[model samples]
Target: MFKLAGQLASDCIVLGDFQLCTLLLMNDAQYPWFILVPRREDATEIFQLSVADRSLLMEESCLLAEKLKDAFAADKMNIAALGNVVSQLHVHHVVRYRKDHAWPAPVWGKSPAVSYTPELLNERIGKLRAVLTNGFTFAESCP
Candidate 1:
């Protein structure tokens, strides 16, 4: 499972590079989405991290979720770590709304991916990255 392309072999799916996880953007645009990929060499599970790293990862997840909540003014935050689809040991932290496309249900397999405009994507990423940097600093390998 080891890919030597560095931490971001794919689009970041979570908050920002400030944490051990990278943020991935789901192709859907109806909701604010993100994924967190822990920067470990072919890590397969959260428990695989050292005790200290595990604790930090959890803390970072929670904190980043909070930031997403505030920044997006979202109604709820969906945080999950399911490796069934992509087995790179990545986590998901998504902002949800009552009126979103997959409202009142899970977002998975609900619809096709919605593309984002480059300008919009860049703006949103910049804002989220700012929040991430407020209290977190990225290791060289992370960014």
Candidate 2:
């Protein structure tokens, strides 16, 4: 069975699931954002996924973007697959707006990641975990 891996950023809220992916929110408050980490073992490229999985990943990304839109009222969404710092195969879906701090520019390097306060972190996690646990389930089919 596929063992669910640990979250890279636990401070972020739990958005939902992508089946083979784990959807995470950035707690930085820098942007209304989410990250998708496929549960595959040691996959470094999107092409590593089977054709079916590749399609599903795209769908999952869309779902995360939509959820962020509704919850955060994001103006625009940015989806990226850059593996610069962390080598793990992860995708980032950042919600953007014209009036945002880093308008018209990529979020990376524009500002540092904002760490959530302890109380806020717990509260946010609670809210998101409730939504995600209610709306999503992880079925272990393989390791």
Instruction: Tell me how many clashing residue pairs each candidate has.
Output: 10, 1
For model 1, residues 1-143, the per-residue Cα lDDT tens digits are 43423343443333335446555666556667877667788687888899987987887788888889999998989888877767777777779899888887888788876767766776777677677766555433422
User: What's the distance in Å from true for residue 139, model 1?
Assistant: 12
Candidate 2, which ten residues in sequence have the lowest lDDT sum?
Answer: 134-143
Give each model a TM-score.
0.79, 0.74
Count clashing residue pairs in model 2: 1
Global lDDT of each candidate:
0.70, 0.70
lDDT of 1: 0.70
The Cα error of candidate 2 at residue 15, in Å, is: 6.0
- Local error of candidate 2 at residue 22 (angstroms): 1.0
Candidate 2: where is the Cα deviation over 4 Å?
1-16, 118-135, 138-143
RMSD of each: 3.8, 5.1
User: What lDDT is reached at residue 30 by model 1?
Assistant: 62
